[model samples]
Target: MAGMDEAVAELAAEHGDLDALLAGLADDRWLLPTPAEGWDIRDQVSHLADTNDICVDTITGGPRPLNEEALKFPTPEAFTQSGVDKGRAMTPAAVLDWWRTSAARNRDVLLQKDARDRVPWGLGMSAKMMATARMMETWAHAGDVRGALGMEPSATPRLRGIAFLTLRAVPYALSYAKVEQPAGTLRADLTYNGETWPIGPDDADNVITGDALEFCRLGIRRASRAQTSTLKAQGALAEAALDNLRAFL
Candidate 1:
């Protein structure tokens, strides 16, 4: 398992990489629609900012903004729409500053936490897991922003956390998809930049092998099985895992 420090480092790197991309964007480009439905580039950053704020509150037992707002909305989708609405109301610079501040605060708080500390993001997760989750989300959203701007994503070693998280969440992904979990364990041998990250039990019967980038994209639903030709799965468990892989709820 990755330690909190390792995961937090990756999270910071992910934030910095995305920040650089956003910093270069023109004011008009902030309005470009990302792959997420009804969300532009600004909306993506807003969601991250808002989510980080909520995460900080959750960790510290402070006022729960997301929980409070959830009560007012009839559905989860509606609650998210409220965030989208809030982001749409802000200027690009404000949205960017909000994200930067919130993201940094989130990292600082996580660094202060013990690795075994559990935090709530709807689900209770270890400090290390939470850090990894933040990194995964930032990378996924960065992909959306890059896609909107016609830029190809630059895969790096940092993706190891995402790939690890996806594999760790196999059962959750299966549950989220309403599919029955397979009895056998599933494994992944994912490669990126000439490095291979092998996840899961050594003796597992089911295995997925492919580029780390494709597997990470699949985990976030940024790419479908058909879209990731480099990916291959063996056994029913592996197939089901690949089909339903998700990085978040």
Candidate 2:
């Protein structure tokens, strides 16, 4: 069984990787725009740190709203926009330092509790669910950082496991994309650790096959569907699925 310790460790390792990457970036590069709409690198890092604070608050307390209105804004986009606007005034070094400190605090909080503790998220989830969501967010934003800096991201089995779990939330993604698949099974052949984990047996006539990372990337729309060499999909469900891809619930 996956324990809290394992999740915490994975979170910490990914946080460390983020820290190292941010630390190496030049100050000017921090202002570079990323694929995430209006966010620059500095804004992205600060947003991540801020998200950690929000997560810590949720885990330690009862329930909290994950959206900006609940956070006193009209939308998450507004909140992130505000963060970016504020972050633009700070130096890149300051942003990276803040992220490091905030991530450490968040890690401490998660490490102190069991994985099953209840925590409130925008979509109604427990602490474990929130943690998994954060893991996915980290990976996605990290991909943004890597892409902006022309850096290649290294994949780990631990990260892949998290991705696998997050990908299971495809129905949520489908809802967000406003795309639905026909009643049928879709087989996903995922390769990791010299083995394969078949993710689905949906009754749809579609199948999506690829390396774990590539599949995760495509499912999240982080990597263009055309860029994936390992993916093979058949039937109308495959194309429809690609059209409505989303990484978050």
Candidate 3:
């Protein structure tokens, strides 16, 4: 429960950050297209608002059918675009309010969540895993919004939560490619701002070492392994996981 409180608090802080970022955006900025291809700021908020409700439902009860359907979309892009069509009827302010409402509910869930709770995120994950995924996702979309507005994403320790999730997802990453996970321990060492954050066994020969932000970016599919040229892998499985890592698959 100590860790749950921490993860929940981190998630809450990130959500507040995102809400503040959008709260001051002008109407025109709301219409700006983000790094998510066809999605504008409004669409991004709509997606999160919808997913926020799903997150709370997963904890407090169950996700609605529409939300459940969105999760099953064949591609991440498709899933993001699914709700925007009908959502277009709503004003930007209305949409933002909708997102805020769900986010509020999510914050409540964060306060009350326990370790035994689990959400069917990606390939079935625990409540803490769900919170981490939500935090990473909100952070990623915030980057998209910032990119659209010609703003820079502020480097922060909060990113470590996402980075930690990426490091812990090694097995899931390998499974995505159906790569035969090699036997033996695997290690990943991430260096960010002069500090080295390591995961897996220190004695393991097989390792993936790189920038912490780059590793988190890789998990969200924001940046590819090649783009983060700093990353170096010493084993076949580690390399394979690096190539195919995705926060959601």
Instruction: Give per-residue CA lDDT, model 1, range 74-162, as digits (tens).
Output: 98888777777878899999999999999999999999898888776655678888899999989999888998899897698988889
RMSD of each: 1.9, 3.1, 2.4
Residues 1-249 of candidate 2 have per-residue lDDT tens digits of 235677777777787777777877778888888877877788888888777767777766634335432577777677656656656777888877777887887778777766776665666665555666677778778878887788765577755655555456666766776676555556666787687767666564677666877777775677887888877767666556655556664
For model 2, the superposed segments whose C-alpha errors exceed 4 Å read 62-71, 184-187, 200-207, 234-240
Query: How many clashes (backbone N, Cα, C below 3 Å) per candidate?
Result: 0, 6, 0
RMSD to the native, candidate 3?
2.4
Candidate 3: minimum summed lDDT over ten consecutive residues — where?
62-71
lDDT at 154, model 2: 55
Global Cα lDDT for candidate 1: 0.87
lDDT (CA) per prediction: 0.87, 0.70, 0.78
Q: In candidate 1, residue 14 scores what lDDT?
A: 95
Worst-scoring 10-residue span by lDDT in model 2? 61-70
Runs in model 3 deviating more than 4 A are 63-79
What tens digits encode model 3's per-residue C-alpha lDDT throughout 133-211?
8888789888888888898765578877787777678788777777877776777888878888778778986888987
